[model samples]
Target chain A: MSSNPQLRRAVTPWGSFSWGYSDVGADIFIGLGLVLAYAAGASNFAFLFAGLVYVCIGLAYTELAAAYPVAGGGQYFVLRGLGDLFGFIAGWAVLLDFTIDITLFAWSSVDYMSQLLPAVLASVHPWSHFLVVLGLIGLLCLLNVIGVRESTAFQGSVAAVDVLSETLILCFGFLFAFQPQILIHTMHVSWPSMFGLMQGTSLAIVSFVGLESISQAAQETQRPASVIPRTSVVLILTILIYAVGYSNLALGMQMWHPVHDAHGHAIAFWQLFPGNGDNQGKAVALLSAQIPYYGLLAQFYVPILGAILLLISANSGVFGSSRIAYSMSTSKLLPSVFQRIHARFRTPAASILTFCGLAVVVLIFAALPQLDHGARAVYQRLFHGEDGITFLGDLYAFGAATSYSFVFVALVALRLFDPMTPRKFKIPFNIPMRVRGERVEFPIIAVIGFIGIFSILVFTLITHDIGRVAGPGWLILGVFLYFLYRRNKKLPLFRSQPHDWRTAQTSILKNAGELELMDEYHANLRASDERKRALR
Target chain B: MIRLRTGFYFLYVALGTIILVRVLSFGVRFETITGIVLGILLIALGIYRLFQVTRVRTSKR
Candidate 1:
């Protein structure tokens, strides 16, 4: 951190991994509830499908992050590789996801805690779920503005506990309570149509969305070229196993029973979980309490732990968005106001306040259905009754799919344009392509990743009625703002400066801080020179 | 020096083995397959590390 609100390279490999892990916090707790609502017993397969794409996207990010090693994550990669216009688009899309991350995680944190504390649950009554979620977002925003550092130790501890607890629950639940035959039968019996499965898979992409934090910390990581690859592999595996395993386990437990009213009339679970259109985000707590030996642990520990982890994630989102906004401001992609630091706290107060304000706007649209007659019916009809959390998931999926597709493309462009730049690690299975007297290796993994993620984007458009409208609206507005910024700066909006590997190399070298690492690199270069001399 | 190095290696192996045995025996009774698999992986890694330590020692000699 700097007085001017710049990112610093202080994160170790484990710290980087913990940051990614914790930012993804309790996604399973919320994800299981959402995916099950759509795909029913086939939720496991949905997660499995999304998890496969996540693996591709994760590897693609690792390759890009290692090569560029910048703070803006995908935004910087796309900027250097593609150009400023596309870069702004990518950064703006990610901003959308980060804002949603802040609000959604905060809302779900209270939703999880409400299972334990009746008082917090009661707050959902008066002004609807709006007041509580807004309060949490405001609290997180204020914390960020005041420059409260989220301790890496706290992140690591929470990540370790969550992983261990979930692993235990999965293993015991699978061994004792999970019936493979029953899971298979349920998958068959409640198996959705292809259309339904597609929708569920698109939504399931939300579970792995926050893993991009690993790459976002690339500039902050020690030995990022090696560290990102190591940390991201473990990060991907952890999320993959949990997402797929939990979905199957939830289905096995038959946790999707329809809610019954006080008079015992059957109502849909999604309808009355919060009655006035909010999601039942505490389904994971309830599901855990149903697990045999884990029931007691789930009753006391799960709700509280789940709440803390979600709040941590919400806090990370605020930090992530402000940092990205700061980086963009430095690049001249955003208004210079976003770059302004608080005189007292040395934090990006402008970016924090603006993004939180945007989140508050989204919360209002989500609660539109709770309004009086004319507007209520209109909102329901237009957005299709998507609660705030579910609405956030829709936009998250959209943002993830959009930015990831661009990143995959950026990976290919960087490989082609900067062919001589040293890549410590490359995505597996590259095919050589000769263009303009230069041989560039095109990654087969990135190609597949682009296709898979693009398809998810398309399906997300087709399936999420609200996201299809709102997501494009956000991008169009971003494009409009980008052009305005370019015109004001007297810079070309569409055209960009020619690709220069020297500039890219300079960025990498400027960010490289470790003496031992520099020593090792120089030694390796010297050895290469010696080998050439010997051959001559 | 060789004795001290080998002692640390042996200690590492012993710790890993204890984890392995506990996970296999107790984890099975508790029906946690994840613990058993994770424990076995740790033990294999420990043994590999031990071999590397001894190999380095012998080569130095």
Candidate 2:
């Protein structure tokens, strides 16, 4: 083994953006259908509300990632700003999201591919579908354990094509098929009930999932502080546009293919895609396939494209989970076993295997409702008929909401305490203040983001019966393990271990090859020290 | 490749302008406002990309 181990800084600016894009951008493929089903005419509104909160969260992440440039992402920030306990909780919650990302996207990828191969459809051939998802997960795990450079190049190219294709679909969709009158009419007539709107908004947050990929990939990114802000802001806006644009277009567009309701009545295009078992998972492909003349070609390629994108997203989960586990283990939050890197491959093989195994476990649990008649009956009776992709979505929303709530608080806390870290990107609308003889900027947007994300967490608990039980159960299990591990190591359970953050920051900056940032950080420390001496 | 990339940015600028004009021509209301925001964002993004390209070229020179 090498004496000193480190993640190579090879991810360029575009690679960094594509890393985040391939993960988060794939969400709309699944999210659009779920939001449409629940939020109905108010799907646009749900997306709008969630998109706004996402912008806030994105801004906070950009600021923090640029400052820290670490692999643990929200977990690392929370550990620095809050204490070890809260950081562990955040990390644990993020781990749940990452694991679910693997299963959810893998399952949905198969669903999209099933558009081309109807026999493997999850709704029809449950076992075959389950096996396919398992196979994909295994393949992704092997690919990650071997190396990431090749996969990153593949991810970037796929992301570029998908982006171009989506833009073209939207342009053609709006130009030929979209009607403002239809959208307004739908909103007026088919606006969802209060509970439905709440549920839809909660699910809409799924479209903004995988923002953590930005910060997660930061450890391997070249000049992260400079690149992250530009890429992240664009990513945020691009996603927001796609989410709102697609929802509006779906509601307003004239149907290219004739759709029928349950009673054999003809219905709008939006009415056909949602609630339909076959269409829900491959909604983006269906949406693209309805775009005027483009539909002719899109019908063939969009499904293939969607499947590839979703698989890439699933691969991102494998990459993210292992890296986060590695980071956590390095900080002594997890067992040292998780920190083991393969001597030849130089990858976190243990973390990849363990988390990927957990993903398999999650996939099995999600598949329980689909596996047998008795299990299906029990799940339906107990969890309000939520299973399959919906089950995965519920857990995903819960994990993301839980971790994001902590991240906002961490952003605020970091702003207050660690003013010495030179933040290249600061969340706008800050109220500068002096607290306990320290200069601090009270981030107003972070508070708003906290309220928004916390409400979504409450919404997830209130609306998702399965998620309400399973999500907290996951956290409780994690906390128990944390206590046992800490006790075994003779470490403080509640209190944070003493850490010299200045020295750590210097090392991090030096390793990242950011001498200029290190100098600026030193200057800030010197200035702060002088001020303290003057005060004394 | 650089020219193609610049062309894509130009397309973005045009697309954003078209969307903005089309939405505004329909008259501003609750339903159309989101489109307005999206159009504005797209335009800004295109401008930013173009600016970045110019800056890079100038730095190289």
Candidate 3:
């Protein structure tokens, strides 16, 4: 094996799986709340729907990551399969989700804490809630600036504990409280309209959004081709089961303790839960408290566990957004200011500051009342619980669905255009096609994935009331910046470099032990370059 | 390797058939157009995989 200093792949398969596993911690805490807010009695169907889509996307990501392992997640995959323009769009969308991830996690962390102490709940007066969220973000930014990486042992321990605790809670909860007849009755009574179901499905996609961290760890893992497929498949299945099971269990509990209306009448939990935002943000902890034997366990255990996991997730988002911005700058898609490092801490201080600023702006936007009553009315009509956290959720769903759709498209295109790239695992049920005498396989999985993801993207536009506007607003800004950067660099606005594709292919092949193919490709590339120089 | 490839082809066919039967039995409601489209796509893919199996057998001969 050729020993390059930067090519040290040390992570095992378990390690690779753990990388993605840790990132999924706080998704349960936040996602259940948002889905219940929209789908109410049909939250299980929403999760099941989104989980199927997640399965398809996960397989697509596995195929792409195995073929072209890299660190930039979906952004890098789309960049290579599609060109720079689509690449920029995908990356920009991911950046939006990351910013929201930070804001939402910080706000939810405080929400969980508020369940423990009434003083924290009372902090929502005036600017106090906003100040607390900002303070949390600031603290995380400071810690990142000081270069505090979570120890691998810490990540592993938290992931294990969280998984075990959640499983026990679900198992015991269902054994005690689950009734088939009650679930059926709830589903019949609270069956959502098609539009509402689609909206809930879109929000449910946010629960599995951060699993791309698995694909992003491709280059760092030993034997990525073999490891990625196993890890990603398992990861997708685990998250799917958890999301669907928890949503269904929560619905059963809601049936037992139906929320009462003002006239002392029983009503759906979603209607009253979102009223004044009491239970809107902290839905999961409240659900845990309703579990039969485990009700007492939740009072002491759930709040602290939730707070810790959410804080970690928020910390990850702060650092992740800055890193992605720095990468975009390095690739000349953004201004050089983002690439500036702090002299003292050697961190991307400017990028961190910029993303934190964007998060602050988003928080303020959601906090402030919309000047246009028309806009607020439309938002309320489409979605329940119109608050800062839900607004953040709308953007998160939009960003996640949009970028993931691009990944699906990229996976299909690559399978068609770049076959023979060693894939230890491909999405099952591919059809062979001879495209211009090249043996290419068509990815049926990616096609289904694209259909699912694109539908969600459309639903986000129609259902997310606020997201439809804000998501496009962010994309427009990105396009403008992309063009400005290109003009300043004297590069063509949409031209792709042939060298990049060849280099990415060669690097992936070399790692897969297809060194002979790598050498032949390099030799041909060199000969072609020499011929061009000779012609010149 | 040949048996493995053939098995995979058969596997695809089985999966496609199952999806089609399940979806068609579920009733073709206006809201379930998405499911119908998916079933059709899977069937097409399955037939194509069968063709791939034939290709592999022919090459061996």
| Chain A TM-score of candidate 3 vs. true chain A | 0.87
Extract clashing residue pairs from model 3: none
Query: By DockQ thresholds, what CAPRI class is model 2?
Result: medium
In candidate 2, how many clashes are counted? Answer: 0
Cα lDDT listed for each candidate: 0.73, 0.89, 0.71
Candidate 3 residue-wise lDDT, A1-536, digit = tens: 11112323545676666667766657878888888877877777777778789889888888787766665678877877787888889989989988998888888887887888757553345266667778888887777676523333455667667766676566555557655445556677887888878878888888887766666557556667667887786677566656765776666544445557789998744454533454767777777776777777876788877777777777667656766666566566678776676665556777777888888888777665433456556556765437777788899999999999999888877777666455667788989887644567888888888898898899889987679888999999999989998988887798864446676678676775556556666775676567658767
> Can you write out model 2's per-residue Cα lDDT over A323-363, one digit (the tens) per residue?
88988888889998877878777788888999899999999
Best by DockQ, which number? 2
Model 1: CAPRI class: incorrect
In candidate 3, position A428 carries an lDDT of 82
Tens digits of per-residue lDDT for model 1, A1-536: 24454455667876788878888656777777778777775677778778788889888888777766766888888887788889899999999988888887887887777777756463445264568778888988888787633555577788878876776665556555655445555665777787778888898888888766777677677778878877776677667767766766665543334457799985432223332323457666776776777776766898888888888788778877887787787777998888787877777888899999988887777655554457667767887666666788899889989998998899888888766555677788989897544567989898888999999999899999889999999999999988998899887889874555465455565565534434444564556567658767
Best by lDDT: 2
Candidates ranked by DockQ, best first? 2, 1, 3
When summed lDDT is taken over every stretch of 10 residues in candidate 2 chain A, the lowest stretch is A1-10
TM-score of candidate 1 on Cα atoms, chains taken together = 0.83
Give me the displacement of residue B35 in model 2, in angstroms.
Answer: 2.6
Candidate 2 versus the native: TM-score? Answer: 0.97
Regions of model 3 farther than 4 Å from truth: A1-15, A146-152, A219-223, A254-261, A265-276, A336-349, A370-385, A507-536, B1-61
